[model samples]
Target: MLARIFINRPVLACVFSIVILLLGGISAGLLPVAEYPEVTPPIVRVTAYYPGANALVLADTVAAPIEQQVNGVEKMLYMTSQSNNDGSYTLDVTFAIGTNTNMAQVLVQNRVAIAEPSLPDVVRAIGVTTKKRAADILLAISLDSDVNPATGKPYYDALYMSNFATIQLKDAVSRLEGVGDVFIMGQQDYSMRVWLDPDKLASRNLTVTEVIKVLREQNVQVAAGQVGQPPASRGQDFQYTLSTLGRLIEPKQFDDIVLNTDKNGEITYLKDVSRNTLGAKSEDIMSRLDRRASSGVAVYLLPGANALDTADGIKAKMRELEPRFPPGLKYAIVYDTTPFVRESVHEVQKTLLDAIILVTIVILVFLQDWRSLLLPVIGVLVSLVGTFAVMKVMGFTLNNLTLFGLVLAIGIVVDDAIVVLENIERWMEKGLAAREATMKAMEEITGPIVAITLVLSSVLLPSTALGGLVGQFFRQFAVTISVSMLISAVNAMTMTPALAVLFFRNRKPGKHAEDKEALPWWGFGLLGGLATVWLLTPILGPSLGLTTGEGHGESAPGGLGASLAGLGATLVLAFPGAVGGGVLGWFMVRPVNWTLGFFFRGFNWVFDWATRVYGQIVGWCLRFSAVVLFVYVGLIVLTGFGFSRIPTGFIPMQDKGYLVTNIQLPDSASLERTLEVTDAVEKIALETPGVAHTLCLPG
Candidate 1:
């Protein structure tokens, strides 16, 4: 079957190669590249605050009812809730790891029906997370007074500057490519904190609730209907519609806000009792840069945004806006995530290159011929290039796992090429012409190679249908390996045979000119002896030596019989000691590290003592031979168990990025506080050379 392929399908093979190459290139351009997929789906969190409820009470009234109603969801994991002393209840429902969040959310809402009527009306608003909390580091924002001359102070510190900056910065960041949302926090603006005198409130017959209600009502802005527009004045032959609304621009507006009437029938306005003022809100202490009071803002990039480019864009914008900041204040980016991504990619690529070179050198050394090396090399290249195209078509990313798969598969792919090439070489060395050799090689090895490839691919094909985070992490790797292996098989069947027929005649296995060399006398003698052993062993039932009942008389004390008996006894006795030493060594492995460190400090002393001991026993031939043989046997035993002791992993870690950071914080910490701590740590991170972005989240 394969001989026909080698004989007649050369043109088809060439055409297929061209088509695969083009398709792969196109796929490479279009595939999405990410660190990992979104293995975790949408998680909805509901939090309710009850100022005086205990944990037990909160659990029974608020948590239990919600759980029962939200139970029995098809794709839901479970709903878990916790209560605290402050009377807050937070219920978290985690869906099945990869379930579609949008669909699951609808099902969850419908299930919560039975519990809705039992809740206390006093329970504050239930907060549901509409979007997933992302860990993506989008853009880093910095403000510098030195760069923008028109600005008076750090916008982050200046109340007016911060107010205007928030509006402008938020607007600009939204325009950048791949930006999901922009959040600006940490700037405090003017707020009226009414520190009312209890006595004054009693005397005025006013309650706290009444004051709050009037205050809220006075701060309102309502939209009125649009003012009338003339048809003749409107553009494009149509009348335009414009809505009118009242705007509150200053704190003085509150002074004229009317309250309820006094006993004397005069209107009691806000100006009657409390003094109106504009001052900074009652916020926590302001932070600083270089000990000068300053504020900072952060920008989170969209999930799919390229970290490097987004960071560059932010830095460029800062350069343009620096001149607008205040004097004595400076701004700088504390951390960015781009450099880390770049470094990780570079390290993986470098290791891959080194692996390729090593594989090539190995092929050359083992084949010991140029043509044999070329076919497998070409096969490897074709397989890898084809894999890239498949990845592009499948929208897979070039991540750590995927690259690792490629590295591992590189060795296995060469196995097929080697099998085909070796078989063809064997035929050629037997004096077959190139065409005949190619046909014979394919005919003999094609089935085995295809079967092996299929077996390997089947082992990994199940990964594509796996569930949860583990599946998302490993699926791409499995795909890469399976694809590469299949391509290699194709290459072996097609390109390898084709190349062999074209180049085999010119590249003979050895340099000797003789067409046939006669087998040597020793070779024939060895073959005859092996044949004799095979034919006799089966007939004689594997008996090389037999203890026959032909002992005539009792042997003398010093004869051969006594010596053989002593030898057997000695061998039997030595087994126990050898086995005991091995068990002792196995148990002592834990102490080896500390012991080696100790002896390394005194290695010279130990070596000198051993040398003197060896000198004293140099002429003892029996002792020397026994010691050498014992040491060799001990080594062979230890070698057998070496694999069990050493730590085994899929692959050895390449020396590249080891920059992993772990952070911990107490529970109930707000996002604002978390960002504050993260910012401080980021300063230290950015100050260190080669340190890329710092990522932080609440535990």
Candidate 2:
């Protein structure tokens, strides 16, 4: 048996656990942290612009043709399109939840290519591009400005602020590790606009189209061949290259372009008809922060990159750029999804750690010796660490799914080690030597231990075998539990036995070990009451999820309100559980104990009678064997149909703490009006006992 193999090489077992722990720790750092496993359907968006077209025109001319071509693309679940009065078209194509997004995008692109010729000329000129859209943002950094400390200048205009961000900040943030793209919001590029006076143009006998054509023609640059030393062999005289600066780089150059000359000797220049100035391209978006013109970089994370690492990398890059920023320009974190991701992951991690603590206490309570808790605790730690290496190998993240699975697996993993240790202790209590007890215990219990591990594996591994996105969500949880179990099984056969023998050897038995007496009536009552309290305390915190899907009657408020509410709830619950538990203990002293004891004996009597009755029923069925067989087969068939007709849910949908608080104002509420409402809310919140802060984010 494998137990024999491991028992022979106890040092190897110790080394194995140590090595796995080291590797798993390293893998934990490497694994990505995300909010959820990718469960949402991947979406590809196609955008087009038609400068002067209305929404109806854009829908009919720009959106219709593209949607027709992209509709039947591979794995596409559905397509939706929208047209705006500003002459923009957005066609969103959602693919199957687990579709290969890159390939799907390419397919949509090729189809959009086929529709290109059908679109209007202006739409084609403006160009249509596809972008992969994730449901949630990764991070967003605000480009805010401060009053110059030295110069006393106000914040710059939105146009200049956006250009500086696009030119200096966008590329820097984009190059950070794990960042997919950093798109500048409210961005406007440098451009030139020529103010056309229709009266002057009419006086000049020129039209807007003619001016455009003349400018386009005059803006051209021509290249002449270079001349050096008369072709190096033919000409005798040294020659310098002839050159001309043909491109227009100034407003004077543009105005000086000759459009036409009057036959009556009155010459007209382009400057007489129009005025040109350097300015920003037209912009439709306005970003603001602290009542100043603001800009931001919307950072997208790579598909499976570590979010915390990505966020930290971006903030680090931002810090490096901050010192070099232009005077009056500063940066702020407007929004970052990473903090929530970090909190949730850490919360689940804390839950697991708390679980370990809880299990340790319970183990100590049961064993009554700290030394006996070591093997089980060691087994749990080793199994958990070892599972991380497996997670890294399998490309699983340390998200809610995997972490919750580990939380559930704690009991199973510690159970294996606890069982093996308890068996060794039992064998020693039979008056056998430590080594003999270890060997004898393993011989008797190893098969059953292995069987139980296999049985647990059988239950978990099937969830991994399920198909589609739901299956993918469960895959990490199931695989994690399965790997932890396998590790625990190995530890049970090796580490537990080895540690038991090593520690128990040469150890003297205590008085309780030699002669243990049953607990008296009062002692049993006290123990039972304490167990009830122990069970009730932990349940109180998480039981918030079970109260009609809301916490504390109303949805829990954000910030300190939630904390205060939870504390109040614990106090409220614990008071009753404590008082009633004590009362229960007192009542169970004698009369209650007799009643419980009698009831349990009656339960045992019912079970014994059932066993005897089953035998008699079996004999009667044997007399009508054919009829009984038919009836049993019919019941099995009925159960099969019953199971088939049962309704299924993917999983229990917990609140996940994504509560949105809506603040409403009058229908025609201006920005100031909305801020008034916000201020009023904050004022009330400030007056409240536990609330300390409030945040308002406008959509």
Best by lDDT: 2
Tens digits of per-residue lDDT for model 1 on 1-699?
754574566677667766776666555544433445445444555556564578888888777777787777777776667876546676667776656655766676665555667776556244322232234444444333332446664434445434545765667766766454554434555555455556666778888789878876766667553434443444545444555434445556766777788678988766666777766552333333332344455666544344444555565566576666555545666444544554565577688778888998777555544466677877887887789888866657666677778888889998988998888778877877778877888888989998999999999999989866777768888999999999899888877787777766665554322322122223333444444444443444213222211231111122234335543544444444445445554555336534544544365467678898888777574568988788889998899799678887633565433354655657767657765776677578768887643433222
Lowest lDDT sum, 10 consecutive residues, model 2, at 546-555
Stretches > 4 Å off in candidate 2: 44-70, 79-93, 100-133, 147-153, 220-225, 229-233, 236-250, 261-268, 368-371, 454-475, 505-699
Judged by lDDT against the true structure, how good is candidate 2?
A: 0.74
lDDT by candidate, in order shown: 0.62, 0.74
Q: How many steric clashes between backbone atoms does each model show?
A: 12, 0
**Residue 31's lDDT in candidate 2:** 74
User: lDDT of candidate 1?
Assistant: 0.62
Q: How high a TM-score does candidate 2 get?
A: 0.68
